[model samples]
Target chain A: MVDLNVFTTTTIYASVLALLSLGITLIYMTTRVFNFAHPRLSLVAAYAAATFMAIYARSAHLKPNLEPAETSIGYVTVPFPASFYLVGVVAATVFGVVAALVEYYAILKPLLRRGADYLKLMIATLAYDFILMAVLFLYNTHRAVKSALSNPLRLTPTSLSMTAYDVSIVTEGGTFIAGMFIFSAALAVALAAALYLLLYRTTLGVKMRASIENPPLAEVLGINVERIYAIAWILSGATAGLAGYIMLFATSAGSLKPISATSPADEIVVSAFAGSIVGGVNSIFGSIAGGLLIGYAETYVTQLLQAITGYPEMFQYARVVSMAIVALTLLFAPSGLAGLLRSPRARRLLSRIPVPGRARGGGR
Target chain B: MEEPIIVVDKVNAGYEKLQTLFDVSLEIPRGKITVIVGPNGAGKSTLLKTLFGLTKVYSGRITFEGRDITRLPPHERAKLGMAFIFQLNNVFAELTVKENLRLAGHDLPASVLEERIREVFETFPRLRERLDQKAGTMSGGERQMLAMAIGMIRKPKVFLIDEPTAGLAPKLAREVLENVRKLNEQGYTIVLVEQNVKAGLEIGDKGVLVVSGRIAFDGPAAELLARKDLAKMYLGIS
Candidate 1:
């Protein structure tokens, strides 16, 4: 029988991963640049939320009383104002937008105007990622020192837990359902729906799609391609911010430690990129599928292998699954799942492959 | 002579650091088909692109309807009632025919946009039937019709078309030229660059032969076609 707790935690993780992958795919479609700083953009939001929660906790006189709870989860602290979590969410989203716009205007736009090729533009994002990491490091250290010296409530500036702030429901069957799971799932669905409506139903969305398909042709048709691209960046940043904020709950549910300042850039970036690539970097919805596949596989596959092999240490190798999947995707379907489904040539190739029951048609 | 709708005054333009059109001057009269033909790499398409502000103008002035537009960007030029149809990749291949028309009239009011789409349907009824079909799946001739229909949706004052029949079969090429003539008869000024020199000049009101980015001859279409020496030496026509 599958463990309910593990399933809930895995679903939460998959929802957040889907949002992150969608942001990456949207940015790629608009700018045609692989933004290495994108994961750091999410980290910016995570740090922003953590900092906001700390400030709110201090102001509300909530003493940092860390104790072990009855549950399997490790640490528990005094809950702050429930409304204060909203403040954290807002702060995360705003900071994400500001950071992304900074990358676009300060770095990407200037390089593009100077006629930098894709390689230089991509390298510029890498440099920007390093810069963000340094900034985040210094800020987290300063906050840690300041909180240690002056504040009675001692929260780690680099890491955060959302358990205290999260509301949970105990099922009649004695199962615990984390609020994060519901919130993340609902938000991901809402975001996907909103994006679909915006892209298909609105004039600005049509203009954006047109610009993405052919910028020069769009320009001749009087569409401001630059403005559409800026809007895309705004959407990318917003989604990244939401993903970062919700990720804290997944961390709390699974490992009992909140995501650290370095976690997104160091660990989650690989899975996010793998999701986008395996889903088809050119498709928005495909990236979501990619994210879910990677997220579930990373958790459940590790659990299954560990159980079968009687080795508890197999969880550490979970990321290898993502790497393997990415390699297979690139080898067989470089354009990703969307191409296999949509492109006639790819479909033809698929039909040619000999299946046990399916009759093959003659080659054109 | 009728008043020229577009006047290129000694325009020297090309892509960055490459000067293709050198001190070239021309005038396109209103309500007439002006055909621009030349040998390979003679900057025929470049001249069309220059007229639509797509190329870098080192030093020159292009006046459209008595307004200077040499410094305007392509979008701004488009807003000034000029439509440029490229030789290839002119249509958004991923978009449906209706979506392409909607994007062409992006800034129009909803009612006006619908009205314009209806007008476009009147011109090319095939687009109405294939309203939901992806443009990339359409045949070459149908794609050209859709491109023209997209241009027509905006009701632009002038059409700068570059090799509309570039890759089509000969029969379809003739049909496309016939459609161009029909568009001209409907009172839209057209400046067309064509590789099929004979067919292009046959329907052209004015003929311009550009050789190595220079205007070798500019006159009535019949007069230019009657010149056997220029036709044999430049156009490889008997």
Candidate 2:
């Protein structure tokens, strides 16, 4: 019997990971900056989305379905409104764009103007990541304390209002999954298609490609290189935020309750980085494909290990499989798997075979 | 002689405190090709860079059509009817020929961009056949043509090209020089930096020969070509 649950879960994870890798690829390609703060930006968006969900619940005057345990302050719960998911996503995306633009203009731009080397800029991103992580911890603690939940960890909230919401869908094949799983996966594919069209079919997209390939040439050709970088940051951040919101909604059922304030960032960034590097850091499609490959491999490897050991605890080390993928890809394929497809040998093979009818060159 | 389209006067510049040009100056006449020929390490490329504001100009004045633009950035200079085609990495290697042309004519309206692309294709007819092909995959001669086509799409009044015919076969070199002369016929001021002394001077109206970062000679191209002594002394050409 095939386990449809593993397949569904793998797709969910792949969609989230791919969304994240796309942002990473875009930021790295245009600015050549390894943004450690990328995942932190997603965390911030997740919190912002949760907060909007809370606000929407309050404004609608909904009452909690389940009463909370007695605490210093009474349990304040608002029944979940499933449609508010859209509001949360929009809010998260907006918040992400604002944060990214601020970082670019206020921090990154100044450093670039001061002639900071790439190494310094990369270190600066690491420092900024720490600062954002601290902020997230503080925000999570604040929310927990105000809601009368125990805040002993002083990190992410102990439990979120989303725990009370249940949004699973039942299929005829006895497969169970959240409605959001489908929505998020569709959203990820749609975003990829949109990006492809923007890159190939628009004038601004052509200029962006030009800027990436050669900034000096683009500048002399009348392209505003700084402006292009700024736009790239905005797009990357917004995509990250959307990914975070979707992940939160899918996992928490239209709400967010991070296991730990700092852990969310580390997990997302690590997975996305592995995916991007394995796929091809420079190519958006490659990163997405990498994400999906890692997702499926991780799930299968864990299942195989558990079947062998007959111990569910073995599944905890599934992340080691992702690490292995990263290490192997870096060692054998420095340019990533996409590079192999674009290698000269592949091109030669592709070019050698002619069509069944007509002559070569195809009348072009 | 035509009025100066661009003048670099008393310019002292270099890269990061290593001064490569010492009080270098030249007048690029309108509608004429001015070739700057020099031996290796004679700062021929530096002079062109100084004019484009790519070098650190410690002190000097660059007037373009009578406007002082010494401290202007390269993009601003380009916007002011000036275009530069670098000696290397001049084209976006990953972009297709049509995409490269679109980027060069980014400032034009969609309708005007199509017309400009058509003009470039007419000038470099070979490029039209490879509109969808990546520039990096093109042959050396074809890449040179694509590079020149990129600069031409801008329709600049003054074009600063460095080593346009470098690393090409003899026939291709002559063909590139022919294209440069044809561009000059269209009333564009050209400042060419070249190693091929005979070919560059043959088509040029004026020439500046630099040796050891200083102008050893600046005069009519015919005079410089006729003076074999100056050629052997500075340009190392017979």
Candidate 3:
């Protein structure tokens, strides 16, 4: 029996990957044009974390970084011991919001104002990606040594390590399959639930959905589609920031090279696009499902291939396999996994079943 | 009695490079039903939509209630007490009729919203039977009525109805026309555009016959009816 430990590890990594992918999946679905700059937005967010770390390093006495709590799995413990986790979250969130505004002003707004070709906007994003990547490289290098405009980044190592149970989700014999399945599926399901509630259970979600469906129609109804778009961009930015942190944790890195260098976006942008498609791009729950499904397929498919074909090199080809799945899915199920999963009858049935406990978002 | 309820002076509007309305100018009386009747593509709907601030008015001036609203957004126009009932008459198809009414009547007193909806429903008992029904599932005739009722929920100063009787069977069309007449009599400044000349003239207090983006006849409904040749030339009828 092959040890499923690798699958367990990959599954955890995949869960975090799914969240990052969700953002890519989401904006792509609404705008329908691939935003090459999204992951770079992740890169930009890494800069934000760098800034946070810089500040934390400067502000001594309060343990600058949280020790990786061995028992904590789904969340990060603030390295600083001052018990100001909320402040750290806010600090990180503000950086995300700022980056979002920058993209909105620089890229999305001008294109929307002129009603520029979406394809052209997407193409223009390439230049922005290159620019940001160069900026990050310069910034990271300066942080490593010294730089102008930005105060030199300072990293002081702290001593707080989490145990195996804290960081690692160990899969033992016999119970490995069930344990790993529940763990992986749980993240995707929880994420899907939260996203569903946010998109369906909030007025902002209704307006956002309305804008996505028909911008001009929403405008006619007195909903400010332009403002909605800005908010959506900012929200997307915040989520991208979370995704950046997720990537940082997965690799256990404080130095922003793989992330800040723009490879973070490029690396998993395909997976995000794939996950988004696996879920209906428009449906919030759909994106999460898409992410989870891609995560499973990417991990399991590679393992399965490795198991069947005594070939070691096939593991490296997993991304290509993932991309191919996305391409094939797009070609056939263009509406995406949501399209395949949600037939009209299914929607009607779901509609009839009034959800319990949670508010209907029906309140005026 | 007062300044014209709505003013359009030398308005030129259309898609890029192709002008649909050419210096289309008209004055609509306050507190009266003003109907614009024309053949297909006479810019009847376009004129009303431009006045409602849908399509951009390239070179023209429009004033509503002593305020120059030449370049206001659709929602801003709504805030200025203006409303439009589209020909398609799409209510938020995803939402229920009640929710649709609630969104429209958001500007109203919170305490009386339910009572107001009930009163409006009593006016058209058809809606009373199906308050919770989704607008998408309703018949076209019922949809038009609900749409009209929705427009009134906000108590607009000037309500522009674009082809309310469109795509309905004759009996349903008559029902819708009667409802429009009833609403007008209930003290709403109504500007209507319709291709159904006879039905439009019947409900309309004043009718203007438009030809090729310009008004050819602007007078009482009876006068337009008596001058059959003028109506024929403008609307291509015998």
- For all predicted structures, in order, the TM-scores are 0.88, 0.86, 0.83
lDDT of 3 by residue, A42-89 (tens): 656645564555455455434334343333243343343433333334
Candidates sorted by lDDT, best first: 1, 2, 3
Listed models, DockQ each: 0.52, 0.54, 0.35
RMSD to true structure for each model, in Å:
5.5, 5.7, 5.3
Q: Give a tens-digit lDDT track for model 3, residues B1-238.
A: 6788899899998655567888888888888888888888988888888898888678989999878999888878887888888888357777678767776665567677777887788678888777777778899998898888777777788889899888889999998888888887888888988778877887777888877888788888767767879777776668
lDDT, model 1, position B97:
84
Return the top candidate by lDDT: 1
Better of 1 and 3 by TM-score: 1
- Backbone clash pairs for candidate 1 read none
CAPRI category for model 2: medium
- The per-candidate TM-score of the B chain, in the order shown, comes to 0.98, 0.97, 0.95
lDDT of 2 at B50: 83
What lDDT tens digits, residue by residue, belong to model 1 across residues A51-108?
7766776777665443424444423332444666787789889988898899999999
List runs of model 3 lying over 4 Å from the truth: A1-17, A24-33, A61-79, A82-88, A143-198, A252-257, A344-364, B107-109
- C-alpha positional error of residue B129 in candidate 3 after TM-score superposition, expressed in Å: 2.8
Predicted model with the maximum DockQ: 2
Q: List A-chain TM-scores for all predictions.
A: 0.85, 0.84, 0.76
What DockQ would candidate 3 receive versus the native complex? 0.35
lDDT of 2 by residue, A1-364 (tens): 5576656656777777777787888888987888888877877787777676666656665444444333333333323455666677788899888777777787777897667878988888888888887877787777444453322111125333332343454444545665556776787788879888988788888888888889888887777787888888889889888876765644532112243566556765777888888888988788888877876777787778888889977756767888899999989988886897789998778668776753544444
Question: What lDDT score is found at residue A180 in candidate 2?
Answer: 58
Model 2 local distance difference test score:
0.78
